[model samples]
Target: MLKGPAGALHVDDGGKGGVPVVFVHASCGNTTHWAAQLAHLRKRRRAVALDLRGHGKSTLDGGGPISVEDFAADVDAVVDGLGLQRFVLVGHSLGGAVTTAYAAAHPDRVVGLFLLDPASDGRVIPAEQAAGLMQALSTDAWGAVIAEYWAPMLAPSRPEVRERVLSDLRATSQVGASAGLGSLLTFDPVTALRRYKGPRLTVVTAFNQEPNSYQRLVPELPSMQVDGTGHWVQLDAPDAVNTLLDGFLSSTT
Candidate 1:
């Protein structure tokens, strides 16, 4: 545990070797969310997983509603505390939004980028749906809503994967998730990304794996697809995701 701007943050350090890869988990998620990615990536390079301010081990009681900046601050603390010179930033879902914010603000510190089925443009998540989700959280109905919505979308095939996803979602604090969702609404990756010019790779589910799915992120940041996976592509196809990351990291000459 390290005392960051947001207090003590739970960070999983994979030791030293190659350029470090910092993994960020999605909202309503913890360090465990990146279990597969860190496990595989760490073998080759220093892979680190962190629990955002309000998630997992960093579950501090106060943090003024989660926002991209808040998430970025956590990463800031991690990087500074660890004395990392340069590293690759990997974020999933909401974590990707935070990664974009960080890379935009600190492009020099980042050597590479990977956004895994992340939520970037506002159009990605319907306004009506976002409002409805917040309303559900307001009513203390997160459990029911998670089963009804996310389970089918994220855990369609794998039973064990589904359970862990739900467990993490439920473990997430309602306050943090709701605020983070609102922040996502105001997030503009297009603007943030404009500041950061580095090797880019955007991985998305095979279903929505196309130029249009990423919209502006397409030509700016070359993208790829993970077959037979959902939003939690890392959980469903870690090997495929690992292969993609390895290829991108090694091929970047």
Candidate 2:
């Protein structure tokens, strides 16, 4: 575990001396969420997953305001602390937004990026449409919120995959869910995407619940879509996600 400005980040390091691949999980997620990917890819490459502030082992009992930049800074701190060179940055959900912002802020540090169901374009549901979902998350069905919202973002072929994602969702606290979702509501990574020309690929689930914010990037970036998985595609479709990531990493680097 490594300490950052926000809290202690739990990281898993694997592989020998290849370029490092660091993963940032979505809101309400911890490093454990990336277990499937870690288990599969660790033997071939160096991999690391971080628990964002207020999530997982990194708790913010009374931390200051949490901005997208602050989250990006935490990522920067980790990379610098590790003395990593020639690496790829991967992010999912809100972590996607953080990775994009980090890549934009420090383009030189990034060799490529793999964004899984990323939140770069911002919330697709309007404030009005999200009201009900928000209320449900705050009052009842917090776990359901994670499942339902991501259900639309995943491919429909995987029945067993849903349970794995649900387990992680159930672990997220109400305060973290509300606060983390709130942070995502205000973040917009469109400008950052435009500025970054490095090898960038975005993987969107076939049943994307949010609007096609990924489309907005088509003009400025390179991206693709995967089926049979949800917003938490890494968990629901690790094999497919890994295939895409391995190919992308190999091509970009």
Candidate 3:
């Protein structure tokens, strides 16, 4: 466990040399989400995956609304604790927003940014829809609501993969999950992304490949859409994800 602003944060650090890479799982997810990536990347480079505050084995000590900036602080804690000078940042879903915030604030510290099926824009969630979800999150219907919201995203995933993702979401803290969604409403991905002028790549599923998506919004932003996968692209198609990551790492690092 590494000491973070919130509390003890769990981190899985491995491998030896080459450019270090830090993996941040999606909201309500843990380091296990990156098991395949870590196993594959650690062979040649230092690979580290951390459980964000209020998720996995990490502790959520402070109270009040949690913002993307707050999540970014967790990344800050991990990199500082590990004494990393510059490294690659990989995030999924909510984690993508967090990594973007971090890279924007500390551009010099992040050599490369990789987002996998991430929440790239606030516009993706309509205000009315966000409000309704927020209300449901405050009641017993939170779990059901979350499951419903994630149902379509898991359609292309394998049965076991889909079940495991749902199980993780169910086990997530209601407070944490609610706060995470709240953060998305206020985060400005375009602005944050513009602040970071570095090597970056956005990998998305068919769900986020819409015309108004992140890549479309920022035309110069490098991105790739992987077919036959869902929101958890990393888990649904580990081999493809690994291949893309390898290419990104090779070109950037």
Predictions in order: lDDT: 0.78, 0.73, 0.90
Query: Model 2's lDDT to the true fold?
Result: 0.73
Which pairs clash inside model 1? none
TM-score of 3: 0.96
Q: Kindly list the per-residue Cα lDDT of model 3 for residues 66-179, writing each as its tens digit.
A: 889999999999999999999999999999999999999999999999999888576667889878778889998888888888899999899999999989988888887887
- Candidate 2, residues 133-195, lDDT tens digits: the string is 667767776766666666654446366666655665677667666666766666667777766
Question: Which residue ranges in model 2 land beyond 4 Å of their true spot?
Answer: 63-65, 123-148, 154-159, 209-211
Q: What is candidate 1's lDDT per residue for 2-119, written digit by digit as tens?
A: 8877668999998568889999988778888788788887776788988887778885566455568778989999988888979999998888889989999999999988889887
Model 2 TM-score, all chains together: 0.85
- Which 10-residue window of candidate 2 scores lowest in summed lDDT? 208-217
User: Best-fitting candidate, measured by TM-score?
Assistant: 3
Instruction: Give the TM-score comparing model 1 with the true structure, all chains together.
Output: 0.89
- The true-versus-predicted C-alpha distance at residue 237 of model 1, in Å, is 1.1
TM-score per candidate, chains pooled: 0.89, 0.85, 0.96
> Could you tell which candidate, 1 or 2, scores higher by lDDT?
1
Clashes of 3: 0
| Structure candidate 3, residue pairs in collision | none
